[model samples]
Target: MSTSPPPLTLEADAVTRITRWVAVGALLALIALCLAWELWLAPTGRRTLVIKVLPLLLPLAGLLKHRLYTYRWVSLLVWLYCAEGLVRATSEPAPGATLAMIEIALCLVLFAACAVQVRWRLQRAKAAAALG
Candidate 1:
């Protein structure tokens, strides 16, 4: 018999896929809005840099939603983004503070949704594994 344990598994579902993409879509929309604000409404310089960094989160989010791998890594990333947002919030002044807070809240929501997706996928995989 093999000595190693089984690889982690997922039980991706259609509705789950749709839901994940919906979340991803909303995040992307936020990203676009941030970019627009950065290019338009934002004061300039570092704010653009800070918010532009957000686009980097997209690929990992897409990968997670696609089930390219287990969702744990993505969850960690989302948590990191939330932390970054919080740090930004602390540094923000009156006008920008609200936007920073909004970003933080959205990140938290994304984190929860991704975590739930992972849990739900694992549960389905476990049920299938048991049945088989």
Candidate 2:
């Protein structure tokens, strides 16, 4: 007798899970860095603080919940951070440039994690669908 596969959930593999958490952690770190860099460390001395921190909040819930769809879209959202970082890192002075470098690194981490997680989860889902 043949058996069918069980229903699939958003569940992922160990590597995918680790990657997702890494993305979430990197995103949180990036947000904190942006806050401190603008509001305290460098203090652009403008009302830019809210602008820097607000966009980050949009993805927090999805990332916290480990939603694959979030991983997919947030990966795209990260390029804005990367572009900002590249500009500041190349043109700004010391500490600001340094913080920009950190932002770039965090963005890269988040992007990589999101990509790997999405790929792994999609593959697993496709395989499961085939099995059933």
Candidate 3:
């Protein structure tokens, strides 16, 4: 009486896999950038600024596991870093501004990867549910 939807194609699977890796790579790069900027390349007034990288570490395990919920939340979470990047890129002098621009680029990449993965997964799920 009922029919199932077509399974996701090899291309769809590959796209999701690529997005996952991109998200993880961008996150790691962002963490390293933050640490370098705050600790070595351009130390801020307060050494405590290095703590900013800590929050970025929280998502690694979830991302590595490809948790959909994690992707959704991380998309939202990345905005905070983007905001900081915007503020610093405009206000800070040369070295700090350069690091902030790098942070912004990484944040944009991470957000895009998370958003695309979440959207594609949700669409796949919805199509499967509707057909089955």
Q: Which number leads on TM-score? A: 3
Better of 1 and 2 by lDDT: 2
Worst lDDT window (10 residues) for model 1? 2-11
Model 1 residue 111 lDDT score: 67
Alpha-carbon shift of residue 109 in model 1 (angstroms)? 1.4
Q: lDDT per residue, candidate 3, 87-130, as tens digits?
A: 99999999999999999999999999999999999988888988
Ranking by lDDT: 3, 2, 1
**What residue pairs clash in candidate 2, if any at all?**
none
Clashes of each: 0, 0, 0
Candidate RMSDs in Å, in order, are: 6.0, 2.7, 1.2
Question: How high is the lDDT of residue 113 in model 3?
Answer: 99
Q: How accurate locally is residue 51 in candidate 1, as Cα lDDT from 0 to 100?
A: 61
Per-residue lDDT of model 1, residues 6-114, tens digit only? 4543435564776587557646655755565556554557664646555446565555446735355656665665675688679877545666677777777666666
Ranking according to TM-score, highest score first? 3, 2, 1
Q: What does the lDDT read for residue 10 in candidate 1?
A: 48
User: How many steric overlaps does candidate 1 have?
Assistant: 0
Error of 1 at 77 (Å): 1.2
